[model samples]
Target: MNDQTKTQAQARNDWWKGGVIYQIYPRSFQDSDGDGIGDLNGITRRLDYIASLGVDAIWISPFFTSPMKDFGYDVSDYCDIDPMFGTLGDFDAMLAKAHRLGLKVMIDLVLSHTSDEHPWFQESRASRDNPKSEWYVWSDPKPDGTPPNNWLSIFGGPAWQWDARRQQYYLHNFLVAQPDLNFHCEEVQDALLDVARFWLDRGVDGFRLDTINFYVHDKELRSNPALPLEERNDRTAPQVNPYNHQNHLYSKSQPENIAFLERLRALTDEYEGRTMLGEVGESQRGLEILGEYTRGEHRVHMCYAFEFLENRRAIASWVVETFEKLGEVAPDGWACWAFSNHDVRRHATRWDLSDAANRAYVMLMMAMRGSACLYQGEELGLHEADVPYEALQDPYGKEFWPEFKGRDGCRTPMVWQAQDEFAGFTTSDSPWLPISPAQAEWAVDRLEEDPGSLLHHYRRAVALRHDHPALARGDQDGLTCDGELLTFTRTDGEEEIFCAFNLGDTAAHMTLPEGSWTPLAGVMSDLEAGVMDLPGWGYVIAKREGE
Candidate 1:
């Protein structure tokens, strides 16, 4: 290769620094064949539509071989594709197509654990004397034939499961079918690295590490203290499940996880430009853990927390304060921001927004400082679909019915057209998850025809991020958390952009900092109508003169 080719390769490798990643929930994105399940070919078919959104990359959720217990989170194989998705050739074809379209591809990596059906685990649990026997966390039961400790599973009940074959207990913080790896063992770490290398060698650009903090646990099996009722917040699990009552100390998020992260980082460093973004899953110290994990250049490149994806109201102050707190806690670390994902309620449903409020959040999400991840169907203002109990595939939902519905609402299939069987997503007999008729009407084809549609506004909002350096790589500053008005400035060297948002139903106003500013692309509906009056949940963008 020529020097120019090498330079171009290096640039492409550093492509994620200020990039936008569009996440594709594989099962719900598109079904190519009449199999009722979305596949690699389906993603390959939709590459043109994804590229049209002006995103720099696509982060696909888990598609590895799995039992689908946690829908693809429970991986049975690390080196091959699940028949539900497609073959290795299909994944290669999708990656090639994405690269041709100038989009990077990042696959989900479930490193903390694997499906109990995985060959490694199958071998590890068979006899206890096999070469892979120590790969998973295995322990002897207490003298009273009780669990090793009181560590509770996020799903429900004890985290430890008894295995009669090995005559010992194994740890699983999620579904009983998913066994946690003993990262405390060096051989296990080397094996996981081999799994990462398999994909890296296959030309994947990066990985979205699932449950990154759950790689290790307190080895001594110390009983976690109960959280005070007043101090408890049940965002992580079903409200009906007592899993939320205890502080998650001994179960997961152990300090030893950091050393293992360094090992993962070192492997990525070996492959020039490869990156990994960790999903930090702690209720109280989420950001603090994020900071520690990504503080140095040698660790994971970035980490995302559940803060922005929670089902809570976020005013301008809360938004600013969240980032400010992040800044204070993780000064050198990077964040990947997203309002919606497969695991949570869609932001539209959580905010209970009218269509207008939904449009405003599109602008606010893109304007925030950090890399943005746009979940599938979020651009069209898709809300949570009401999944009937009969069709619910989520075990969490089934376990905690009525009081808490699980993630089925957010996992519904994407709609591509207003008029078609399965909303033009598939010609399949039936989609794995049913599509909402209401959602089908808001499909991309219908929205594209209307110039003032939320779909068009989303394109404009995302376009703004690409047009201005301040929106993408700028430093956040001059933030004010006044009333419902959330205002801030983003500066990148000489370029400065002022941004403001009204995150409430009440009409709110804030005086602009005294300066000459040019309106680049105002996102507010009332702004263009000479109603400088900030309506409920509206945003404005202005470029300063000096900038």
Candidate 2:
């Protein structure tokens, strides 16, 4: 290996590149104090379990001080830990334990906005002439007493909230309690950067930036144009959500966001092994923004859009088209792909996948060109929990009601023991959200005893990716789709591997590409000669004999 080759190898081994990241929704993971809510101490106790999954890192959802209006996303204090989640000492302990187990910790950072109860927001809304008054986006109402512009909130209704204290309207892209910060103000930008520095100094490995594209809004406060019915897709928001009616041109994904990202990247670069994984939430232009945000070194290291999570059925054609689009628009950029997370419906139930399909999807995600994220219960093949209407907590779901249930179903507690009344998640009878019967059946203890369980399959699949350099950090090529079958190739210098998937239930036959190959174990599939016959939801990962 020469100097250039050594440099390429080091880049490939960088933790964020094609590495597996497990997402832990803090409030639902485990409850150490038995208060029916997961806390920092609980996560500290489970560090070994997380590390056993063969993931390179863990991305924990928000556990910051907040009023819980939107859970921890509406942060009231950026530097402090919420009492419900334990103290700063508890967080440090968790961080130490995670590092000891060789798992990097990436925390969720909600920098685009802050809770209304935050001191800065309280001071900003106090009086328009105050020094911090411009810290948040505030504007005078229209002459007719309507909002300053036609922007709409993601939680339904107009995006502007009339504040009697300042006699002006404030902007909130999500819930009214979560007010958008004035990134246009250099002071606000500097303060946010300081927040990032605080966490970095505290030993955090990296950050998962929430709503990264919404960092900067249109300075002119222009109204967003109406989206044509034909162009509107239910990818970012639910079909019942009125937020999909507009194109959102002036509201988010603004050009100015790039400069702020460069500044943020520069800050992260100050520390070794630090990275940023941004979440882009646009419906039509997600890939384009992803490419722009991560195009160069001085920007977010990687990004993931709503495409895979929103697709009810990740058909072969859909997967092929998505990657093809990425290759065209973001050839130089990187992406962190995920099938489920804290905010959406779990893929197992959302897609109505069979046992085979579930296994196949996991294999496909691991074999993809970039990094991957696995939600907490995905390894056990847990579906979305059934949260009763009366027990719902998500404001988004509560507002939509029977028409479209909110995300509480997916945010339910993880079932650790099948026989425990609380599924071993907590000793308390009452959890934040009930553990559904379906999830209980796939409990960790139960899956651990079953060798053929989805849990073991996930473990082996993840390990296989790590063992094969071509699958983990190689460049993807030759993507093609034939009816319900999808095929692709990955190569890293002298090593080459072929991957094929049958996304349907019935057996499918296809002619394999010309190559002297050897089948790799762990992935489910059957191949004979040049003809490949795969059962429904079957897949194969093979290495070329001599490439």
Candidate 3:
């Protein structure tokens, strides 16, 4: 390749840095077949819609071979595609189409465990003398015939399930049908690494490692200590769930995970432009763990914790404090921030923000440092769909019932045409999850016709990030939080930009820093003379030349 070509290729290889990733949950994105379930072809059919948002990549939730116990997270086979989703051939076709549209594809990889029905787990549980006997976390029952320790499952109940075949208890962090892999075993780590290679070889650009911090547990099988009420946060588990009671030191986020992450990163490095985005689910020390895993050149490319996706409303102080803490904890590390995902309530509903406030957050997220992930339907300003008790499908929600209604609300089928049955998600009368009439109003077809819609706002916000080098790849500085007004500056070499926001329902004023600043396209505030006036939920992005 010519020098200019090599430089351009290197820039593309580093695309995950400050890149915008659109997340798609396969079951809810769209269904191509008449079976009411979305498949690989459905995603391929919607690539044009995804690319239209000016996103750099697409992060698809798990579609691997599975029994759908936890949707597709409980993998029965990592190498093959689920027949419900489509075949391996369908995945190749989707990958080819994604690349052709100039979009990188990152599939979710569940490495912490596998479904009990997976061949390896089946063999391991069959007998203590099998070749794969040590592939899963297993231990003898206590003398009283109870669990080996007091580790609790995130899905509720004890983390161990007694297997009559081996007369021992096997560890399961989530569902009883999902057995945690014994990462301490070299063979298991090697096997999981092979799974990563399989996808990379299949032309995938990267992976979003699911439950990345839960890969390794304390080898001693020690019980976790109780967390003080003051120390406990609802970021990882719901306030109603008992999983929040423990500190979770022994059950997950073990230090041994770092070496495995390094190994995974090394494997991905072999393939050009491949990135790893890990999900660290720790409530107390999540950012610290994210720092450790993504601290160096040899670790995962970026990691995201639940800081921004928590239940609390994000005021100006909260936003500034969160990133300030992140800066202190992971100064050398990188993050992929998102306000909503399939696992949590939609931000529009979770934050209960008005249309103006929601639009302000879109600009905030796009202009943040590191990278960003925009959940499916976020562009259309869709709220969390209300799923009745009978319609609920998430196992996590079912375990915690009324108090914690589960993630099904956020996982409902994406609306396409406002007037179409099932919102054009499927021709079938029944979808995996029902689409609410309220959600259908924000359908793509409806939003496309309205230039002032949130869909257009999202596109404009994302375009600003790509247009300005300071916003896309600069270092954040001069962060100052004044009550409900937050201001910061981003600088990259000679390019610098000042950003300010009013994350409240009251007017605010800010004195511009000394510079000849010009208002940018994404600004929503009024500037006069030397002072700037921001209405409720308003923001401004000004470029300061010759920094």
Candidate 4:
């Protein structure tokens, strides 16, 4: 490539830094052939709309060959596209189209486990004499023929399943159909590397490693101790589930995971500017794990935790403290932030909000110092729809009915047009989850014509961040925990911008830092009076004195 071409490539490839990524859940995004499931061609047809949103990239959830027990999380063939999604050729066409539109593509990779029917697992379980027999964790049950240890699965019950063929208990941290792989085996690592190389060779920009921390377990099979109620971290599972009862010492978050991550990073490093973002799900040490996973020059590029995603109305003090803790623990690490995804309730619905609160939360998320990830329909200020019990498909929701409805509400199909049948998503078949008339009214086609819509606000907010150096790629400082108001400043040398949020129900006062400043964005509440009158949830963005 020539000098100018190389420079352009560098800029285009450097899209992950401070870039906004739009996540597409393949099952609910779009259905091209109307098989009642979203497919590769469907994603290809929607690339233009994704680019129009001004997102720097697209993060697609798994579409690999699977049994769909966990809806594609349980992979049967890592190297082939599932017939439900389309063929391998279709994926390549989608990648080519996305690159043409200047959008990076990242695919979800579930390395922690595989479907029981996967060829590797099938062969491994056939007999202990097979070459791939050690690829999965198999151990003798206790004398009473019970699970070896006390590790609990996030899906409920113990994390061990008995294999009649092997006459031994195998570890499965999720559904019984999905068995955990033995990261202790070198061949297992090599096999997974080959799977990753298959995609890299196919021209994918990066990967989002699902349950990255769960790749290994404590070899000693130690039992995890109970967590005190006051000491419990509330971000792991639903409040109604007992999965949060333990400290999680044995099942996952093993130190051995770092070496495997380093290996994956080395693979990505072969292709210049390629990236990897791991999903760290530990409740107590999630941010710390994020730091460890992304720390140093040889590890993954970034990682995300459930901190902000779990807490809907996160306090101003909590935000400041969490970032501060991240800096102190893992300074070299990068973070990817999001408020909603296929796995959780939408933040707009989780946090009961009025007009001001809704607007402020969006600004706060965009302003945070990191790469941002926006879920589909978030730009339209969409809230989660209440799914009837009969319509719920999420296993978690089915298991924990009335009290804890599953994630089906947030996984509804995207709405494209206000008046079109099925919201212009698909014409021939019904969506996996029903669409809300309220949500359909906020469709992209309708919002595109209205200048004052939430879509416009999102575009402007993202543009402002892109234009301001202080807001993008800047050092964070001046964080103060003042009563209900949390204030902080982001700076890049000569430029600085102050940000404050009123994370409470009543008004609070905040004194400006020694000099005159200009209001930047999300100027919802008034700033004239010495005592700032912040009504409930309010936010302010101000630039420092002078230039």
Candidate 5:
């Protein structure tokens, strides 16, 4: 490549550094061919709509071959597309369309585990002496016939499932059908690296690694320590679930995980500008692990922790304190911020924010000091669906029931047209999941025409990030939460932007830092640059040029 072309390509690759990623959960996004389930062609068809949002990339959830045990997360085949989602050619078409629209594609890679139906797992379970027998985490049961350790699955019960054929138990951090791969096995790591390479060769821009922290385990199979109730938070698991009862020291977050990540990083680094965004699945020490994992350039590009997604109300003090903690822990590390995703309940309802509060947060995320992620339905301000028990499809919900419903509430089909019976997610009357009646009111067609809708607010907020270098990839400074107003400054080179948000029940105001500032247009505010008044759950932004 010529020098200028190489530089241009490099710049495009760097879009991930501080760009926004819009997540598309295929099963719920859009369905073509009347399958009632979304596919590659569905996503390709919506490329224009996605590109119009001004996002840098799209992070697609798993669509690999699976038994539908844990949806597509339980990969039966990593190299091929799931027939339900479409063929390999369909994926290629989707990639080409996304690239043509100037949007990068980041596919989800579930490397920590595989469905028992996977060829390797099928062979491994046939007998203990198979070539792939050691590829999965297998251990002998205690003579009395119990699991190898006290490890608990996030899905519930024991982490180990006894395989009758081999008379041994295999570890599974998630569903019993999904067995955790033994990362201790060099062969397994090499194989996953190859899976990553397969996608890179197919022209993927990056990856959203599922459960990145769970790749390695304590080889000795040590029992986890019981966490005191006060110390145990329902961030990793639901409150009613037993998975949150223990401190997962040996089960995951082993010191050896860094090496495997470095190896994966080295592989991605080979293809210039490709990035890795890992989902760190720890409740305690989540930010710590995220910081350590993304500390250096040799590791993954960035990691998102469950701190914001942990089902807690995102109050002003907590948000400021969390960022402060992250700043102190991993000042050099990059974080990918999101209020909601496929796994958690939609933040619009989870946080119970008012319309103004929701808009304020959109500004907060866009102005934050890291990359950002917007879940598929978040832009329309869709709340989590109330899927009745009879219609509940998530295995996790089926296990926990009553108190803690599964993520199916958040994973329901996206609403496209309000007038359509099924909200235009599919032509079939029966979608994989139900289309929420409440969400239909906020459907794309309805919101698309309303300039004041949350959809338009999202577009405007995103455009603001694109227009201001300080907001997109700036250095965050002077973060302070006073009363109900949280204030900070983002500086990129000589461009400095002052931002303030009132995340409270009452109106609030803040005094600007010592500088002449000009308020940015488009945002509603009764403003002079030096002092600003903010309503309950409101925000203001002003910029000052460099000296």
Candidate 6:
């Protein structure tokens, strides 16, 4: 290869690019202390299992000190581990074990907000003249004692909460207890960067920045405009939430977020091989914001685009729209895609896919361009658990019951033992969330003993991406989502791979692209070179003759 070709190849092979990230919701992964909560030691014990999945890194959800208002997302202390999770020493052990197991540890960083109990918030709200008063977003009430503007919280009601001490209205995009940080304040940005440096100093690898697009808000605090009826979608928030009513023009997705991200990226760059994947938390403009946040160097390494994590069916056309739109908007930008995460319903239940269809998507994501994030229980084909009203935990769900059951169904404990009464997740009579009967049936122990289980299939699919350079960090082309089939090619200069998926239940067919291709084994069956017949949830990953 010439120098130019070698440089291009090197550019495509960044540590975070085209890698698979396993998202571990620490609370539900495994309970080690019989306390009914998964802690750092539990995760340390399971580092082998995570390594077994062949994922490059594990993006653990917040275990930072918090009041559990929004679980750990509402962080109280950025520098210390929550007592329920374990001490900072326990976190060090987990990190050491993960690194020893050949897995990178990327923690979820909730920089946009903090719990109301956080000292910073308390000091900021204690009085307006304090040094930390400007650390959080605070505004005066209107003449009539109404909120500053019409910005709605994702949890429900106005985004502004009246602070009695300061006699001001504070902004919170999600729950009122989770106050938004004032990123416009240079001191706040410096403090957040100092927090990043603290983690980096501790030998951590990277961060999954929560609400990357929400860091900066309109300086003038203008009211958001009303969203057109047709433009509102429930992908970001439930339909019951009037948060979807506004266009969110002044509330979020501001142009100023990029500079902050660049500063963040620069800090990460200081640590060799460290990566950052920000979450773009906008519904209508997710893709556009993703393109903006990740199109250039000195920005986030990747942004998790939410178009795939919808309640809608996982059809070919939808995939086409997302891929084509990303290609159009940010041809050079990178995306980290996931069908399921802590915030949304599991894809298996959200899309209502059959066992075979579920298998198809596992392979599809691994076969596509860019990085992929695999949720904890997705490989088990676990359906959304049935967490009744009385057992409900998610505040979002409790606010809008019946119509939207919230995310607890998806956040239930990871099923470890098929036959164990409690699925081996906890010894306590009552765990944080119930391990639903549906999830219990797909326990890891049972699948470990079964060769043909989706769990093994997930392992092989991950291996397939690792084995072939064309599948990982490759340039995708010939992409089409027609009828029931989604077809595309991934080529990394030296070789090319042809990938096809049938999202529908019934069998589907499409003429093979021009090539002498050989089907890869151990992924799916019933394959042919030409006139491919793909059964429902069936897929093919074939290599073109490389001579």
- Judging by lDDT against the true structure, name the best candidate: 3
Question: Is candidate 1 or 4 superior in TM-score?
Answer: 1
lDDT of 2 at 322: 91
Stretches off by above 4 angstroms in model 5 are 1-10, 521-526, 545-547
lDDT of each candidate versus the true structure? 0.86, 0.91, 0.91, 0.84, 0.90, 0.88
Model 3 CA deviation exceeding 4 Å by range:
1-7, 522-528
Error of 1 at 503 (Å): 0.9
The reply for model 6, stretches above 4 Å from the true place, is 1-13, 521-529
**lDDT string, candidate 5, 366-411, tens digits:** 9888999999989999899999999998999999998888999999
TM-score of 3: 0.98
TM-scores of the models, in the given order?
Answer: 0.96, 0.97, 0.98, 0.94, 0.97, 0.96
Prediction 5 TM-score vs. true: 0.97
Q: Residues 14-99, candidate 1: write the lDDT tens digits.
A: 66766789999999998998788889999999999999888988999999989899999999989999998999999999999999
- Supply the global lDDT for candidate 4: 0.84
Listed per candidate, the RMSD to the true structure in angstroms reads: 2.5, 1.7, 1.3, 2.5, 1.7, 2.2
Better of 2 and 4 by TM-score: 2
CA deviation > 4 Å runs, candidate 1: 1-13, 523-532
Clashes per model (N, Cα, C within 3 A): 0, 1, 0, 0, 0, 0
Residue 78, model 1: Cα distance from true site in angstroms: 0.3
- How do the residues 266-292 of candidate 4 rate in per-residue lDDT, one tens digit apiece? 998788667888888888899999999
Mark the 10 consecutive residues where model 1 has the least summed lDDT: 522-531
lDDT (tens digit, per residue) of candidate 2 on 368-445: 899999999999998888888989999999888888899988889988999999999999888899878777889999
